[model samples]
Target: MASVKPWSLVLVVFCIMSLSYFVNGAGSNEGLGASFIFGDSLVDAGNNNYLQTLSRANIPPNGIDFKASGGQPTGRYTNGRTIGDIVGEELGVPSYAVPYLAPNSTGKAILYGVNYASGGGGIMNATGRIFVNRLGLDIQIDYFNNTRKQFDKLLGPSKAKDYISKRSIFSITIGANDFLNNYLLPVLSVGARISESPDAFIDDMINHLRNQLTRLYQLDARKFVIGNVGPIGCIPYQKTLNQLNENECVDLANKLAMQYNRRLKELLSELNGKLQGAIVVHANVYDLVMELITNYTKYGFTTASKACCGNGGQFAGIIPCGPTSSLCKDREKHVFWDPYHPSEAANVIIARQLLSGSTKYISPVNLKQLRNL
Candidate 1:
C-alpha cells in the first residue's frame, strides 16, 4: 500500500490514457440510462443553495467559468463545472442532474437522475456540525429513497427497479469534510481528537460509508464509482491554514487521507464480492490530484498551490470565494477556484481519466465499461 510518487503517477496516468481501451458506446439514453450523484460539495450541483446552511456556494465568482449557466453561479463550489458535471457530459447524460431538493426535481425529472449531494456534508452526520444544517450521507440517501418512490409512480415498479439496477451509474465523491471540518477542527476537534484516536474516527467514517453504500445497493444501485479521498494536505486551504511554503503540503492531512483511502478500497472490494450483480469501481483521486498539484506547469496550470479566488492570505486560502473575493482573469491557469474546490479545467482532466483511463486510475472497470455493460 505504498504511495505512488508524483512523477510516477503522472507517467502512469499518461500511459493509461494512451491505451486503446474500448467500450460499446451507443446513443445518449440508449447506453447509459441515468446517473445518480452523491457525496459532498465536490459533486453538489446546487442543493445547498435551497438550504438555510452557511455551507453554500450560491455566490458570485463560484461558477464564473460555467458557460452553461450563462456565467452565473449555480451553487457549485468551484469556478466552473465539477467532476460530476464533466463525467455526466462524457456519459451522454442530456442535462446536469437536478438537485434533489429543487422544485424541478420531480415527476419525469427523476428519469434522467438526481443529485443528492450537499455542501459541508459527510459520511457521518456529525462531520460538519459547524455548518449547522447540511445533509449527511444518511439523509441524502433518504432523499434518494423518496425519489425512488416517485420513480415507481412515474415508470411503474418493475421498470423503475430494472432501470435503477441495470442502466444507471451511481457516482459518489466525498469524505474530505470529515477530516477538514470535524476531526481536524482547531477549536472543536481538540476534545474529540484527544478522546478518540485518528484510527477510531476513520473507523466511524468507514462504517457509516459502508452502510450508506449498502443502502444505495438495497435501493438497486448496481454500477458504482466511489471516489476515494484526495490529497487534502496539498489543497490551498490546508497549506495556508498551516502556514506552509508554496512547495509544502500539510503532512498530517495527507497521512489521514491515505489511511482512509486504504481502508475504503478494501471495503469497496468486499462490497463488490458480497453484493450480487454489483460492479464497484474505486476511483483513485489521490494520485491524480497529487500529480496536478506537483506538476501544474506540465498540465498548463500556472499555480496549483494557490486559490484563484479569495483574499487576505499568502495563498488566498484564509477566506472562501464570494462576491467580494479577488478573482483570477485566467482561471484555466489555476488548479483551484477556491481554497477547497478544483477549477473546471482541472475537473476535466480528472473526469477524463475516470471515464477512460486504466485500472490504475479507476479499478476493475472504468466508467465507459460500466456504462456500456
Candidate 2:
C-alpha cells in the first residue's frame, strides 16, 4: 500500500473508532444478563406476597398507578415500580427478577435471575419479628444458594458459573427495617438488646451485612451495587411517629442512620479492596432523598413531608396505605407513596441517579459503569 499522510491516517482511525462506538451502542440491548436482588421491602418486588406476613402491599391503592399491572399491586410496596424494578428496566434487563417464592421462579425461569428480598426482611434475624413471618438475610441467602444450584443444572456448571460471575448485577437495599422496625420501634424494640445504643446496634448490622455480602461473592456474583439506608428520619412515618415539626425529621433517627452510613461506606471500601474480582458500588441515598424532602419543588414534587396514600396523622402516615386510606389527588407530586416507601415517580428519579451519577451519588462507580465493567 502507498504511504498515507499522517492526518489522513489519524482521520481513518477516528472513523473506525466512531463506527465501533455506534455498533456497540446499537447492540446495547444485550444489557446485563441478569439481576439478582437482595434486601428488604425497598427492593422486594413481590417475594413477601407468598409469605404469611403482615408487611404486605398486594392490595389496592398500593398499585393504583402501576400501569404495567393494569393499576393493580404486583406486591411492590409503592404506587408503581420499586427501585429494583426501575433499575432493571433502565439497565435494559429483559425482565424483573422473579420473586424467589413465586411458582415461576424455577428451572428455566431462573436463567434470568431471582429476587430474594422480603417486605419485612433485615440484616438480622430478629429485625422484623413483629411481622410474625419474614425472611432474614440468612434465609434470603439460603434461597440464593439454592438458585445457584439450579443455575448450575440449567446451563451446566461452566456456563452457569460464567453467566453469573460475569453477566449479572447483584443489587441490595437493606438496613432500613433494621432501624425502623427493630431499633426504633416505640415499643417492643428488639434493638433494646443492644441497650438502644447506636454503636452496638450498628456494629451488629455491619458484621451481619459483611457476611451476607461475602456469601453472594462466594456464589459467583461479581458485580454488586448496594444502597445505603436513606434518610429514615425524614420518612412520613418517622416524622409522624416522633411528632416533630411538619418541616422537621426525627433527629435521633437521622443521627443513627448517618452513623451507620459512615461505617457502611468504610465497610464497602474495605470489601472492594479485599474481595477478589468483585465490584461493590455504594448507592448514596441519604443525600438524594434529603434533597427531595428539603427542596421538593425542585424535583417537581409538591410535598416530600407527606405521603400520597395513607391514613391519619399530620402526614397521613399513621397507617399504611389500604383500601380505606385517603390518597392524594396527584401521586406524582409526593415523594412518599405511603408512610415508608417512595412513589414510582420518586423511585425513577433515585434509580436514574444511582445508575448514572458520579462518585458523589454512588461511590467507587455507578451502576452503568459497574454493568460495563
Q: Give each model a TM-score.
A: 0.92, 0.91
The lDDT of each candidate is: 0.89, 0.86
Candidate number achieving the greatest lDDT relative to the actual structure? 1
Write down the lDDT that model 2 would get.
Answer: 0.86
Model 2: worst 10 consecutive residues (lDDT sum): 20-29
Candidate 1 wrongly placed segments (more than 4 Å) = 1-29
Model 2 stretches with alpha carbons more than 4 Å out: 1-29, 190-196
Candidate 2 residue pairs in backbone clash: none
Per-residue accuracy of model 2 over 327-367 as CA lDDT, tens digit each: 89999999999999999889999999998988888978888
lDDT of 1 by residue, 1-373 (tens): 9988999989988666544111111223454667899999999999999988999898897888898998898999998898998888888787888999898998666677899999999998898899888998899999999988987887668878888888899999889999998999889999998999999999998999889999999999999999999999998888998899999999999999999999999999999999999999999999999989998999999999889998767899989999888888989999998999899999999999999999989989999888988
After TM-score superposition, the amount by which residue 78's alpha carbon in candidate 1 deviates from its true location, in angstroms, is 1.0
